[model samples]
Each structure stands twice: as structure tokens, then as C-alpha cells.
Target: MSAFSAIGDPEEAEEDEFTPGIEPQPTWCPGCGDFAVNNALKKAMANLGKNPDEVLLCTGIGCSGKLNSYFESYGFHTIHGRSLPVARAAKLANPGVEVVAAGGDGDGYGIGGNHFMHTARENHDMTYIVFNNEIFGLTKGQTSPTSPKGHKSKTQPSGSAKDPVRPLSLSLASGASYVARTAAVNPNQAAEIIAEAVEHDGFAHVDFLTQCPTWNKDARQYVPYTDVQDSEDYDFDVTNRQEAGEMMYEVESKLYEGEVLTGRFYKDDRPSYGQEKRSTGEMPEEPLAERYYDEDAEWERCAEQLIDKHT
Candidate 1:
């Protein structure tokens, strides 16, 4: 196997090769907000001062999963709700690489809720971007964790009886070191927020609200949610957990939401879990395949020893 298959081949990292190879443009609706979100991510990655191959974009299944195909980075399009586990593992195995997990609210908050919770507490260095369109677009209009109360959907025709999942508040409670919110239309703001998340040395989360015109036509009302100017206008109390809670509640209670707070909601530079396990300041100079899996039958001998011990 290639070195990249283990700890990732940093030498192969090339910003120019990071271009999306997809021939067909996205199949999302004309006014769908996914376009801007993708652009913002690409722009943020470009601004991060590293080769695209050094970044691993692991995404879960959904309309958002399609994003993996659009980026030139090492991409892992995994099963629904499992993006966090895969991302965490990838980051741990190759701590030198930047790992990003992308998914929808349903995939991240609903199905992958457990991993989401633990990863935050674990504080593995990675960025998770959740696309919250309120409804599941891939499933043809189903109520998701972020769907507003009483919202009608194919899965909840009688109007959703449950309360919408408050991702920002939940992420804060889950112990994520970096928490933020952004909208798709505000590409610059989104890119900036993502950049902040990338730079943070612990678990970073960004709740990206995008429009799903096909399934969630009503989300258009919040399309203007992307109008916030900069991180200054955002009352993102990156400290004080209480402030984050209050802001989340206030934003949810808005009648005609004016200044939608879209920026870093919380952040603290705690030593990441991976960093705690490291004894060396630098990674090994040799390839993991060569060092760990020797070609001179040493690999076989180690494998037999492990098997004997287990048996």
C-alpha cells in the first residue's frame, strides 16, 4: 500500500492538484445554498497555506456527501452518520494531516449523534462542518434533527411533533473546543469561520445553514440569514458557555431575525487528545508502510506473534 494509505503522503500534497475533477456541475436546485458553501470551503482550504492532499475530507452520506467528489483532497465518502468516527480515526492515524468531516444535520446530529458527542470531548484536532437545511434533501423531504417544530415533511406529514435539534447549543454542551455557525450565501464569512475552525487545535464544529429548495422550500425565509457582515457583528461569545447558551436561545426566539450571529461561538486552546499521546515533536521521517510493515518478512513474524498471543 502507498504511504498515504497509512499516515498520508505529505510529499504528494499539491495545491494545484486540489482542483475538483467532477465533470458535471452539482445537481442541486438553481437557488440551492450548497453552491456557496462548497465555494467557501474551497476558498478557505486555499487560504490555509497547505497542499490539498494534506487535507482529508471525510463526509457522510447525503446530498452533502456529494461534496467529497468536488474536492481534490483525499476524500472518504462514508456511510450516513459515521463521518465523525472515520474522521477521528483518520486524524489519529495521521496526526500531521488536517481532517475535515462534512455532513448534514440528520447524518451528524441524528444518526451519528454518539460519535459527535464523544469526538467533542476527545478534542481530536479536526473540523466538522454540518449542513443544516432543516430537512433531508437526499431522502426527498424528510424531517431532520434541525427541522423546526411543526414543520411538515414526507417523513412527518402531520407536522413534526418533536422539537428541532439545536446544533449550536448541543455542540457547546458536547464540549467541542471550537464552535461556530455560518450560512451558505455568505461565502466570505463562511470561509473566515472555517479558517478559524481549521486553525484551532482541537475539535472544531461549524453549523452551516444552507437552503434545500427542493425539499425545504420554506427555508427561503432564512436565506437572508447569510447577510451578516463579519465576525464583528456576530455576538459569538467564544468563551463563557453561559453566553453561548443565551445566544442560542435568543437566536431561536427571534420573530424577524435581524443580526443573525454567524461566527465563532466558542473556542479554547486545550491540548488535543492526539497531542497528549505524542512523545516526539515530529513524526517519523520514514514511511509508515516501511517502518511498521517491514518487507523482509518482519511483518509476518509480528503478525504470527500477535496471533499466538491472542490464541
Candidate 2:
């Protein structure tokens, strides 16, 4: 039996099981959207029948990084933009653990953009949630990567001249097998999207619009969102890359224009990076964590192999 077998089984999971015995009250300001994210994630895990011990939540630096403090699970608060790489390593080492990486837009799209792109390109089996509040909340409301052009902040006092990063489009272009957008205002939709992302076999990116009411008072609260899947006004096949691309372009463009479009934008039935590596015999059938416990197990020293190659 595996050492990790003690992790609670899904059959015995309860909604309250995810809450820490001594729950820490979130320190986010009154009306902060971060609260909504915490609630939705817990609800989603419960709905999916996932035990806290079976999941790993990795968060990057920023207000969004505080998620690990409140969430009752295996958590890692990584440096800015470094959450994805850490999450990837954990997932590769223990394929049975459900890995979820999260961070703010600046921490993710700006600092960690390279990791994000490559992770998606590799189709790593994990869920990535980007809390896009348009401004740096914990850093005193600076202009973030997702901040709209002409949006003023302490860093961009003259107003931002650069166009905002298009998250959904970027995720699709970077080869994320599953992509979606949700907002804090719509907890039900957010929970549903998170659950779907968690269940997806390949890289899943969720652009979660969280309002920084204190920092970005001018930003939209993402209210009155139109669910593309349920609305007739927007008709595009999520499985069709071209159709999804076109739809994402429109969605990204209209976000700052007072129109909020939210829902699953893209999905592809593709083998994850780990799955492909295993098929190619590059990865062992047993998880690395399991193999490490065997005293007689022969391990390949990758560091030695690299040094030998260079010498």
C-alpha cells in the first residue's frame, strides 16, 4: 500500500472537511473579491468530492497568494510568478495529487508569463487560476498586466499606454487544453468553472476576474456577465480552436468596454505531458514519491547524467 493511501478517500469527503479546524478569518478588506474565490474553491472541491489531503494548492506572491493561508490543504506560497513551476514539479512527482496553481495577474501574466506559456505548451496536468483584479492590490494599486490601457495608477500616473494582456486568448494560443473565465461576483459560475478545470486532464487556465474595490474602484465588478454557453448572442464551439480563438479575441476586447463575457472558452481532448512521457517510457508507472520509499529501488541520478553529458 502507498504511504499516501492515508489521504482521505473521496467517498467520505464532506463540504466542511476542507475547512481548517481553526479557520483564520481572511484579512482582505471589506468587500474584497478574494473572499468569493476562497468560498467558490471550497465549494467546488466539496462538489467534486475531493478530500483536502488529495489536493495541493500552490499560490504566487500577491494578495491572491493569501489563498494558501485560508485554504485547508497541502499549500505552497511561492515567490512571484513561480507557482506554476512548483505545482508542475509536485504533480509530476505524485500524479494522484490534484494540483492547482494560483496567483494575481501581475504575478502570473507579468512575472511568471514564461512559465505559464511553457506549462500550457507542455500540457501539464494541473489547474491554473489567475486572479485578475486589473491592479496590484497588495502592492498599493499599481497598474497590473491586465489593467486597461489609459488606466491610471501610482506606477502609471500619466495613464498606461500599453494594452492589457489578453488572458483567455493567450491561454488558448499557448496550448492550454482547457480554458475558461469567471468572476467573483458570480460565485455559482465560478465554482462550476473551477470544478470543470480541476477535472480536466490537461493544462486548465481560468482567468478569474476579481474586483479590487479598495485599489481599483474604477474597475468593473464584473456584474451582469453573459454566460457564453447559456447565451444565444455568442455562439462558438468550444472544441473548435479557430472558433474559440475568435470568441476569445472579442471577449478580451470587450472586457474593458463595460461588457463582461464569462464561461468556458476552449477545451481540447489531448494527452497531458505526463501521460505522453509515460507512454514514451520516459516516466515510470509508479509515482516518484512511491518509488522513493523502496530501499532496493534503483534510481537514475539526473544530475550525474547532466554533468557527464557536459564533461
Candidate 3:
């Protein structure tokens, strides 16, 4: 038999006057929290009335990377820990396109961690969703960057002695214009937060809490979370850096203690990298992608600029 195999064509889906859809056939396991992320993105796009063609979804290599396959959009499945650069390039080429990048905790917080920090620091105009399931789900339950201290995995059977990364705190400190945490259990909140991120003018990061029930059953306890915005008990201004930083410290501390504190922690109204470049004439107001529409445009002209850059 031929070794190369692909998913067969989906069955004929029921069609209404304006709606004809077959659900995505993802490979996620039963009870996997990834399903929630998929649903949330769909809801968010619908809520925003965004067309599939108007968006670009870049994903890194991991279970979460399969997001592009499920979401209907211009998609790029990039190498492990490399989706952010790809997303940034796409956005730079076409500032009009709504760009989003997704990857698992291991893909984003581990191998791609430097990209994560710099992308936020630059305040790129994009949304980055990190599926924080606390383990490397696609790689068979290995210890991930967010894996709690003393958490035992096949790779760390003796239990991890290293402290886990504080994603929200790191996001804030590294200059993410918006930072938030949401769990798979709260689909409504997830969709809302994602929508907000997409609408934001600068880099927006969401540390999405997912569960790898097949590999890490411990990840399943992310629910019973309280939204800091809706609760009177937690009165901290999200726009205040000091207040948000304090709140994030508290939230990160309690997560390992089995208390899932999920909510928006910080937000800042800052011009994105692209905006700054445009303001200073470092970048053209017209997107480079628009050049493709000019069939008569000389390709040699761009090559001349590249030569000029080198010489």
C-alpha cells in the first residue's frame, strides 16, 4: 500500500441558504482541551464578522500547530518555534491582513521562547496564542516550560527541579501591549478575549490553558477560575503596570497550588512596530503585498533595493 495517506474528503454537509459547513476533523484526542481553542477561534471570528480570506493563521510544530488546519484562513504551518517570525513577516508584507499565531507551551515557551519575548517586546500587530497545557502533548507527555516544579514526566521522572516560566509576567515585562490568560473550560471568555486581542492595535498575548488528558491528567484541573475583571474581590486596574504585575505574580503562584486564576492581567495603548516604522518613513505606507497586483511592475526594481542594501 502507498505510505502517503491523507484525510478523505468530508461528507456532504447540510447546507442552508447561506451556511454550508462540515465540522473540522481534527486529530485531537477525546477530552482534549484543543477542541475548545478551535471552537473559541471560530466564535471569535464570527463575532467580529471577519472573512476567512482576510486573516492569516501561522502555527508552529506541535499539537497546537494543527490549529491552521482546522481554522479556515490563509495558513502557514511553520517549523517548531518559528511561527512568530513567519507571522511577523506576513503582517509586515501586508499590514491589512489580520495575523494570528498559535503553538503549544513547548513550542512557544520552550524552543520558541526567545521569539515570544522579542515579539512581545517589539509590540508587533498580531495575536499570539500559547496553548499552556503544562506538558509537551504532541511529543508524548514530556516536561514542558510551563510544567510545574516537581511534576514528574517520562523526561523528568524524578520530577522537575527547575521552576516553571511565568508566562503572564514575562509577557508584561517583555512589552506585550495586552496580556491575558484563559482556560479551555471557559469557551465564552476565551472567544471574547481572542476577539479583543485581534482588535487590539499592538501585540496581544494570551496564555491559553489547555489540558492534555491523554498524557497529563494533571492538566485537566484548570477550571473553577475567577475572572478578575468581573470579581469585586480582585480590584486591580488592568491598565496599571504595577497592579497587573502584582496580580500576575499572585496568579502564577496559585496555579501550582491548584487554584486557576484566569483573566486579563495587563493592557497598554502603544503603537506597534509597524506603526512606528511607518511614522518614521522606515516602512512604506503601502504594503509590499500590494505590489503583486501590479503585473507590469519591474521585479528588478526590488532586486536593485536588495543590492543597495548589501552594497
Candidate 4:
């Protein structure tokens, strides 16, 4: 089979299928929201009938990065704020793989903000999950990009003066084809949103509101969330860019005000980077990874060529 073709045969998958054979007990603190993310992702993958071998999960540093250790999948625990780049390369080289990249608010929205914007603009076919817990959890309660204004932290003992980043708004403006917000407290919504994100053909961004009780105890637990799709108060077309933008703005504003709104905010039909490249004959129909396996295949070494030219 070609490397770009589907890697595994389809079959019914159980939730336990995604569990590591030698499961390393999760180190997340009791009542930590990270557990919900792991559970939702596993459930989503299983429900989609995806096998462990067919998926590639890349994670950045922080408590969220430990997802690679517990899930039974092709995993890459990347450096801080670098999961998206690595995940993008893997998906481009082997388009058949289901790629999902994850990181915490600080790792993704703060440190990796540039990568996040570009990846979305390029419309890579993958799901990017940002665990937005307001404060830095793994590094011991520092002020994070999502921390509300005037929220006191060890790093900001006097309370932070900077306004928190509007993640959903940024994602929509940066050109993510699919955008949604789900909380760790709402497992069913999270699982459903994840499944949809995975099925999307273009870049999918999920801003996951996770409560860091160990760190940001003052932050809301994300309870009393109203799912926009199920609520009569919210009525907007997810496919309409204008409507989605307006909705996202409201969601971002309400979050810091202690009102939690969660649900799919936007979706668009756009060709992914890989798809566009292939259609324009810039990329081979067969995956680049497949070429490396053929001993006789002719491959150009760009580094060697550049060195020879310079010398």
C-alpha cells in the first residue's frame, strides 16, 4: 500500500484499545482537568474506529505533554511550543496518518503563538488542542497567556496587568478552517468536538478550558457552561465567517467574566495544504515517506546541493 493511503483496516475499536499496554499511571494531580482531555480523545478515536497505529499524537512540554505516555499511539513528545511543526511534517510526509497536536496555554498561545497562527493560515489537516487553564500548571502557577487581567500568580504577585489572550478569536482570524471551544468539565462535548475536529479536512483548533485547581484555584471550574448549539440564547451559522467571528468574540469576552460558553463556533470547507500541493503537482500523489523506503529511488539532497554550490 502507498504511504499516503490509509494504513490500517477499519474495525470496531473499544476505548481500551487506545490505552497503553503498560499504562503509566497519570501524574496529574487529583481533580486535574488534564485527565478529561485524555479520556475524551481516546473515546473520540475509538468511536471513529481508528487504530493506534494509524494515529500520530504530538505533544509539547507541560502537563498536557504527558498524553503521549498514556495513549497507545505513534507519539512524539516534542520540545516546548513545537508540537505543531513536528505534527505538520509528519502529516505532510504521510497524509494517511491521523495527526493530533496538543499543548498547554503557555506552550501554545504564548511561546508557540507564531507557529499556531501560521499552521492555521496554511490550513494543515490536523487537530490542535490547547489546554487553557489560565495559569501555568506544570511549572507551578505562573501567569499564563490566558490568565484573566489582574489575576494574581506567583509570577504576578501584584496581579497581571496584561489582558488575557482571546484564543477563539485569534484562531478564527488566523484562518483555522474549524474552530471550537470545549471544557474538560464537559467530557461529552469535548469528545464530540474532538471527533469532528479529527474528521475535518483542514486545520482544526480546539481551545480546551481546563481548570488548574492545583495552581489557579480562584479560576472558575468551567461549570454551568451553555452549549451554544443546544441553547436558545445563541443562534449563528457556523459556516458563515461573519457570524462565527461575532460569536467567537462574545465567547472570549464572556469567559473572563465568569460566563462559560462551549460548542462548535465555526467550520469551513477548504482544501488542506497537502491537498492543494498534490492538486497543483507540487507534491507527489504518493507520500514522500514512501520514497525513502525504495532503495533505488532517486532523491535530491538539498543540503549537499547547497554546500556544493557555495563551495
lDDT tens digits, residues 1-311, model 1?
A: 64454433324333345567663366677877777677777777767765665688999989899887877788899999999898887777676678899999899999998999999988889999998888888888989988877888888889888977778778878889898888876777888888788879999999987878788886653545533234344454557788777776666555124345565667778788777666364334333334445556332356787899999
Model 1: residues with Cα > 4 Å off, grouped in runs: 1-17, 22-24, 226-236, 255-259, 279-311
TM-score of each: 0.83, 0.96, 0.90, 0.95
Clashing pairs in 4: none
Our model 2 lands, by Cα RMSD against the true structure, at 1.7
Better of 1 and 2 by TM-score: 2
Ranking of all candidate structures by their lDDT, best first? 4, 2, 3, 1
- For 202-272, candidate 2 gives per-residue lDDT tens digits of 99999999999899999988988998989989888999999999999999999988999999999998999
Candidate 4 local lDDT, 162-208, one digit each (tens) = 99999988999999999999999899999999999999999999999
Report the alpha-carbon TM-score of model 2 versus the true structure. 0.96
Q: How close is candidate 3 to the true structure, as a TM-score?
A: 0.90
Q: Which has the higher lDDT value, candidate number 1 or candidate number 2? A: 2
Computed on alpha carbons, the lDDT of every model, listed in order, comes to 0.76, 0.92, 0.86, 0.93
Best by lDDT: 4
Clashes of each: 0, 0, 0, 0
* Residue 62 alpha-carbon offset, candidate 1, angstroms: 0.7
Superposed Cα deviation of residue 219, candidate 4 (Å): 0.7
